[model samples]
Target: MRRLRIEGYVIVSADGRLANVDNLMPDELKFEGDKKFFSAALDQADLILHGRNSYEDQPSSPKRNRIILTRKVGTIAPDPSNPKATLWNPAGASFEAACDHAGIGSGTVAVIGGPGVFGMFMDRYDTFWLSLAPRVRLPDGEPCFPGVPARSPQDVLAAHGLKPGEVQMLDPEEDISVTPFRRAAS
Candidate 1:
């Protein structure tokens, strides 16, 4: 059996928020270093999984295969705007099946998120690259993992059996650091 390694990438504020109350990630909150890191990671991945909102917010990339997660069953089909992307309803199809539908054999499957999507793959992610800007705190913002309630991102990852690796400072000027959390080996 071909084992698919699921990876996640997220950038959060010091208070563990992913976005502001307006559901928008402000430009000042975004670090260039994090963008470079994530872009390079995606460049090497065989497939990418994103929530519907995230997918719609960005311009489509025809070079990379992508699956946009949605709740609408029977909506699995090629995206009309992007030939390289597919709309997938995970409730109607398994992840493996979705990979097959996207013609992905085996490789890193990067899941870029908006809360619920991150929570959905909490148990399956082999590694989660959690980048944080400690100086920035969005008091009334959307959390990195919604429905998780009052827990730090580290606590949430730990609860799901992932051990945090050494923190790498991506940008000292911006006070942005990335901690990779990997599932403990059985």
Candidate 2:
């Protein structure tokens, strides 16, 4: 749409949860291998996009350019807390415009998530890395994407035209594996 390659990164529990009942990711769901893979992938992104509540604090966060989805902003505004961050409302402006405003002409855009954020870009992702923590389960917890359980993360991605790639096992003992779902070629 704007000469951009959009990709998503998320870790879900056995029941398709991104977080616990309290809307926070529990420590049990965190794994070292998934962390390393996610970090490396994020390092290569030209821009990072996520919802207001979905930030994962990392050492490179301050320096990384980010477009934060927020309902507080009428259009696009500078994020006072972070110089590298911009607050954007999709209701007020288009994604292409928001990217342009953020000085992101084109490159890889890493869409980190919360369910609401993930749902917004359903039809636009070029690839989405889905890391699964098979041993963990967050029953009645926050879903990885909207309509999860009823519609799995895989089903959601598939509906958005992305087909699953080969699954890569990140941790054998913990049964953690990641799948890169690429958009099916039209």
* Model 2, TM vs. native: 0.97
Off by over 4 Å in 1: 56-60, 72-75, 147-149
Error of 2 at 122 (Å): 0.8
Query: Cα lDDT of all candidates, in order?
Result: 0.85, 0.91
Model 2 per-residue lDDT tens digits across residues 139-163: 9899998889998889989988999
Clashing residue pairs in candidate 1 are none
How does each model score on TM-score? Answer: 0.93, 0.97
Worst 10 residues of 2 by lDDT: 54-63
Residue 94, model 1: Cα distance from true site in angstroms: 1.0
Index of the highest-lDDT prediction: 2
